[model samples]
Target: MMEQPLPNPILFHPLKHHLGYLRDFAAQSITWPEPELRKAFQRIGGSQLDLYIGPLPSLQIAEEVILYLQQRHLLTPEPYRQHLVPVGYRLCTLSDGSAWALRWGLHTGRHVHLHPGRYSLHTLRIKANHLKTALAVTIASIKYNQPISLQLLNQVRAEWLELPPVTGYTSAEGLGKVLDLVPGNA
Candidate 1:
């Protein structure tokens, strides 16, 4: 039998390929202030945003993009409340037993729990940095075409554990529900 070479892995740029669509969606859905939105996009690098471009538009990506804009102060609170809060609610409400959903639930929970403006800028910056670190790990995993590491999963679990007890809000209640669903949590 003749030897055959292994096929090359297909390389896909998740952000690069989806940037146009994302920009259009942002422009249409999010109300940005004057030229600030344009400035924000110029500052954002392809690798800075992690999007999963698939057959369907991903709510996850939308949430992440909105969060990124929120973090940068490029958009007003209305968009975050309008877009991200709803997505967070949906994610937490519909989360499953899979680890992927669990991670996303935690992500959404954190954002919902620590909404910008509600918290002090100092606190929001600290939490945002933590999220950015976790996102960097995810981006690296995607860049290398590798599965997410157990360490990263543990880190996410730790962050979930560290979340303060839920308050009386419906969104927080949804997050609390997800907390109860976390494996090993009583």
Candidate 2:
């Protein structure tokens, strides 16, 4: 008998809705003004504004999106995927008291527990620079209360990581040049 392929570890609840929303919104960018977004927090049962911002997806809704991206051949190369692995729920925690908790580090995997809005902007800038278009776009969306979409995410992933079986090109810049080859976003 032949061995079967094992299921991906990241396939979990919450990801489905997250990915579904991402795909829908990616077709068009959606903006959530600060007040409306704050109202959404209450609708979702979260009590504070800080609970909703981060590089990683919401703990309750990321796996599905990541897995869908992987299944659709939309994920970046192994290195980038590997970096994303430790970023999910394993890196996050809800504090029993007070209004703060820990978030995982992208590079170090270290748990830096602190209050929200207390991180380094310089590091965020570095990450945005490295990730290319999507990062800046997402940050802008977040700042302006916008919803992001999958096409845009796909565009960004293509820029940062190659489709498997790596060939010509090494970074987002190369990907951007190649994108010009196609007539439309596709």
Candidate 3:
């Protein structure tokens, strides 16, 4: 029996619709209505207040839009700050799911990471697992009586991104358990 060839990994690029949404969002003529912004965000799969992280470009665009809106005072700072918590949670979920897929050798091509530079599938997998572990630790600290704060979550995410990639293993179950400890999870 011969091993089957893996399907080509899908190369990811930011979608035109999403880019259009971002452009319209940044345009000065627009009144920056919250409802309209929410609608556009939903259209780009942000309805649940969770960002799409599969494509690196989409995440980058969302970050830029969030920063732009905040800088312009277009969005209420508190609510938007709370929104960052879920975004971090979503990143952990993505990392866990990606690790599982890589572990099974399924859809390797779909695991592309484009930011900072294009990364090979193997490197992407390693980074995903490492991120999951780092985030899990951060959440655990919160669970063990550390106060939950948006500033801390933001710091953890920024630090994780800046850290050199290293190999690590974190089970989906481990991530899921810590995730429940996140604020608003009840």
Candidate 4:
């Protein structure tokens, strides 16, 4: 008999595991331009870069951004499928084994959500060059006031590569302490 794979793996991505702390850290990094910083904070924190366009611009622009980043190998899609569900829950897989799972809550065309699939951190690690690419994607989406491209992504990715990864945030409090986002000692 062959061994079977576990149905679900553990969540161990340092940044994602303690996303709240990371969000706070990123939010507090900027001081001036309080309003814009606050908005950026919410967008990056929520991992919803679609809001940067004021009123959540068209999904077309977001697709364009995805295309640009994908071409540069900044972000890749994971292999997965969805079961029979409502229209809003459906996703169309691409030729490159990728898919788009957008959320069309009220203002459908105005917002282009990232494929709302629950991807395992382990899969992200082994397949998509680790969480570094996700970080690069987030930075690329945020830094651009207008233009979005592989060149911009590469630049941000290079800067991010310099920052070494710090692991071992087993507890929420511990993560908060290291990020200096919360007011408590864990």
Worst 10 residues of 1 by lDDT: 94-103
Each prediction's total of clashing residue pairs, residues at least 3 apart in sequence or on different chains, is 0, 8, 1, 0
Which candidate tops lDDT?
A: 4
lDDT of 4 at 69: 42
Best by TM-score: 4
* Ten contiguous residues with the weakest lDDT in model 4: 48-57
* lDDT score of residue 183 within candidate 3: 25
Q: Which model is ahead, 1 or 2, in terms of TM-score?
A: 1
Model 2 C-alpha lDDT versus the unseen true structure = 0.31
The TM-score of predicted model 4 comes to 0.28
* Tens digit per residue, CA lDDT, model 2, 35-75: 44223222322121222223333332234334544565534
Candidate 3 wrong stretches, greater than 4 Å: 1-116, 119-126, 146-186
Deviation (Å) of 126 in candidate 2: 11
Error of 2 at 57 (Å): 14
lDDT winner between candidates 1 and 4? 4
After superposing candidate 2, which stretches have Cα over 4 Å from the reference? 1-23, 34-132, 135-186
Tens-place lDDT digits, model 3, residues 1-186:
111222223222222122222222333213444344333323323111112223333444334433544565534434433444543211112222321111111234332222211232211212232223333334434444454344444443344333333233233643332333222221
**RMSD (Å) per prediction:** 19.1, 18.2, 20.9, 17.8
Better-scoring candidate (TM-score), 3 or 4? 4
